[model samples]
Target: MSGRWWLLPGTLCTAEVFEPLLGALAVSPQQCRSVRLDRPAVEDYAAELASVEDEDIVLGFSLGAILAAHHLDRMRALAAVLIAANPFADTPEKSAARLEQLARISVEGPGAVMAAAWPALVGPDARENPAVGNRIVAMAEQTVQDLPAQTELALRRPGAEPMLASARSRALFITGREDPAAPPDRAMRAAAIGRHELVLVDGAGHFLPLEAPRACAEAIRAFLLGRGQDRS
Candidate 1:
């Protein structure tokens, strides 16, 4: 059956980040809940999900996606849409690098993540797009308070493999072809471990929901409508 949506944003992301995707989805605000990542632990930040009801759908981007998959069994939701999902454990190198990033961004201010990872965050072709560049920068600026705690969460995060394998069969995974953070190949391989489905958005990068909101919405619509009687 079709279900209401609960949208969760990624690290350094605010609820406003999903505005474009929400508009594209064409659902009324009353039928959807926009959640934030305030806590520092995966399970802790996910406390906002307590209100989820039967047949509901949890849709999350990046870190939010990983959280939804990892916590699926604990909720009564019918399915999950994990956009830009990378449910694996952080490599030691990734953790160390995140540490360096924390130190750097702490000194450089909130917008520093965009400066440090802009090339990787946006597709090469999109890097020159003034609109995309400006919007993401604004998003980063808006997310100043959540930066440090989210980075620390990324460091303390354990692999979501076990949970994904056990509870995420109903998950639909999507990522951008150009997303270095969740590359298509890696995302496909990761999803396969849990036997979940994945869709790739060509020419887009890590922020597909922002960079290609319509495309993201179309893919999501098809996925949901294709689920027999569930066309939310």
Candidate 2:
């Protein structure tokens, strides 16, 4: 049975964020589908993804990765790719910071959150690239309407260490060298628990798929092929 690719976007992004990476992978629209995860609660959000097939290759980014990890038991996946994922338990400081960001979003609105998070979301090179920076900002704006709920869900989501540690499906965890949200060290630790291969992309920040689509795609492609699950 041939497996399909399921591209999952982060909290402040839509399926469009995966467009460049999908193109780089030379994936046909019919062979791959983007799953929208705009729901507020983790359970509700995970429920929305019940349509995923047993043979689907789940590739999740950030919050989506968290959700994917949460629901790994239900996915009978061919393989899983986690990009800039925070699969470990959240720290007190991290939880507090997320709550503070939520509060700011509630009062100051999404624009303020975006402004504060922009630096950590992309690499220095992306900040210099007007097109990439603007695109990231625009995508954030588009999904900011759901930021409050998304933030709440992300902050409250459970850790995936136990689940990933026992997962039978081959997994790949990719992190950005400069990602403040999920640094390489933290990601490495998490990947160790799952026994997943970890790849750190140079000069990338939190949004590795968007910041380094070609590199991300290549890693994903090689992973899939290595596992003999080539969708191509």
Candidate 3:
């Protein structure tokens, strides 16, 4: 019943972000693998995914979830998809504003963006755990510069809402109740089409896979197993 699994990271996030999830899932019967997509346009990202066929599941987080939706076509042979902490919207206005804000971040510098985004992405423990906080901040500061241009390009590209709506693959949307970036409503709306499943974590923040790794992994395992049962 189990097969290969792919874990795609969030925007500006490397495979390291999914370490906890991957480690926990490693014991599963399925083969666990991770993919790192560079800062690229949605279509281009989708193109890359076109080559990733035959996997049982593709678990995409944050911006990676959006790409998963955009590239759902590339995963026709897969079992299902788990999109985490994504700002799922079909409107152009939201996309436009997002692109614009990203552009500003690109111009103003990642420090400014990180200063604003860090608080929203992580919980207060981020401040308390100076080591973790400092590491993520450093990574964000380095990657935020490319984010604006990358996001703007993605915004201009066609959204995958329609694609996801049509795809037969079961979609599971996971969100943290405390996450300000990707609210529950947003996740719910994004998964309105197809067989959509939603799971909310009470105390977790946007970085649920990092902050509440065990809970996040448990939810994903349950969702995947449930979806498999439905297919059976």
| Residue-by-residue lDDT tens digits, candidate 1, 1-119 | 35678888888777666778879988667777877676678778555676777778888998888778778767777778888888787888877877787677778876766765666
* Candidate 3 local lDDT, residue 206: 77
Maximum-TM-score candidate: 1
Model 3: weakest 10-residue lDDT segment is: 223-232
Q: Rank the candidates by TM-score, best first.
A: 1, 2, 3
Q: After superposition, how far is residue 172 of candidate 2 from its true place, in Å?
A: 0.7
Superposed model 1: Cα runs more than 4 Å off: 112-116, 227-232
Model 3 residue 107 CA deviation in Å: 5.8
Give per-model TM-scores: 0.88, 0.88, 0.78
Number of clashing pairs per prediction, in order:
0, 0, 0
lDDT of 3 by residue, 1-232 (tens): 2556676777666556666767776745246566655555676665556656564677788877777776665575354545454535436676766776677665876666666666666656644555555555676665664575457555655656776777746677777777766777777766665657777776767776777777667777787667422210
Task: Write one digit per residue (lDDT tens) for candidate 2, span 164-199.
Answer: 887756778888888998878877877777567778
| Candidate 3: segments with Cα more than 4 A from true spot | 27-35, 80-83, 87-112, 124-127, 141-145, 227-232
Better of 2 and 3 by TM-score: 2
Q: Clashing residue pairs, candidate 1?
A: none
Which regions of candidate 2 fall more than 4 Å away from where they truly are?
45-48, 227-232
**Collision pairs in model 3:** none
- Sorted by lDDT (best first), the order is 2, 1, 3
